[model samples]
Target: MSNEQVISSVKDSYLVEKRRNQMIKGAIVLFKEKGFHRTTTREIAKESGFSIGTLYEYIRTKEDVLFLVCDAIYDQVRNRLESATDWDNPSVAKLEEIVASYFRLMDDMQEEIIIMYQEVKSLKQESREYVIKKERDMVAMLERMFTACLPETIDEQDVSLLANNIFVQGQMWGFRRWMLQKQFTLEEYIERQIHFLKQSLSTDHMQNEKTDQTP
Candidate 1:
């Protein structure tokens, strides 16, 4: 194809993907505003301004819709963390950026994040696994970044535990926005957390990790 034709094709693909995302985002808003138990496929279709028939083109059930919403969230966090972590940057700065990206994501998509955090259990076993596995993948990705940042003295076990704690604690801030908002703005809250997070991944912990690894 000619360059102009290729460009046109790419643009068309982009618009299609954008519309599909809008449908999903619309559904997330409805799911958050009305709890998942009270929500129906028709409501999601109407909220998305797509016919119920067309909505089915993307998902077969309410569970499917929930999975898609959480998937979008996980995919975004995965991409953000991948983009934020630059090996060349100082470890502390990279850590701050990673945490900052997370809070900014929460601030911008509070409803979506809150919904997934609260409603993932509403899904069936398989659906829940799909979401939870993606969550784990994201944690592993961050842990890799943390590994690069940590001193060689830090052992695998401590780093693993710390990675889990940091991710869970960050999620809590988003899940409890009603209370956390009363305490601070999204940026202020994240900065304070990052400060403590940096201190927590201390040289002493690395030494402990090293000791644990002693053969």
Candidate 2:
């Protein structure tokens, strides 16, 4: 569902978007600190620099706030990825650039990512599904990028799986920061991951070509 379908009583499009952004920013802090189930709507309103009455003007329930937060975070990630990517030129080097950019973004958004993972289960079923679908869309974006760069001999299934692997590897830096950060700096992590991905892609393509020759 679109942000417009979030059931706001406010009619001004710009105002609705502005207020919701404020609400999302504040709600993320509270959700991270107290978690979604424990964070009260009144607290969210106050943190957002508004009153309970005004919060209700923009949302019917706290779940609406959560949905807005999740949607906003996803939008930010997707936009950053799209901007970093050069869609017109899909090459292995370009793919590596995208991977590094994505890993850096994941580092930048660590807290927000943690909040989403922790609180998304609190979202209503429909809202949860919508948020999940947004994630799938992101994976699909990576799949398209991989398909463009990888050899045709690579199975379609492997390309899809590789895309998912890249997506999760980016998030793993966030989710596993406690341990990973102890070992490698963010730059190191991104470099190593890019190296590994490039090697895997090259190895797979070579193996596929070798198999074709054998037959």
lDDT for model 2 comes to 0.88
In candidate 2, which residue ranges exceed 4 Å CA deviation?
A: none
For model 2, state the Cα shift of residue 62 in Å.
Answer: 0.3
For candidate 1, report its TM-score: 0.82
Q: Local distance difference test, per candidate?
A: 0.73, 0.88
Clashes per candidate (backbone, < 3 Å) = 0, 0
- Per-residue lDDT for 1-215 in model 1, tens only? 11111122234555545545766778787877888889888898888887888766555577766766777888787777878888786475777788788668667777788888789998888768767888888788777877888776666777777778777767777678779889897778888888787787675676677779999
Indicate the residue-level lDDT of 50 in model 2: 94
| Best candidate according to lDDT | 2
Q: Model 2 over residues 53-104: C-alpha lDDT tens digits?
A: 9999999999999898889888987887788788788788888888888888
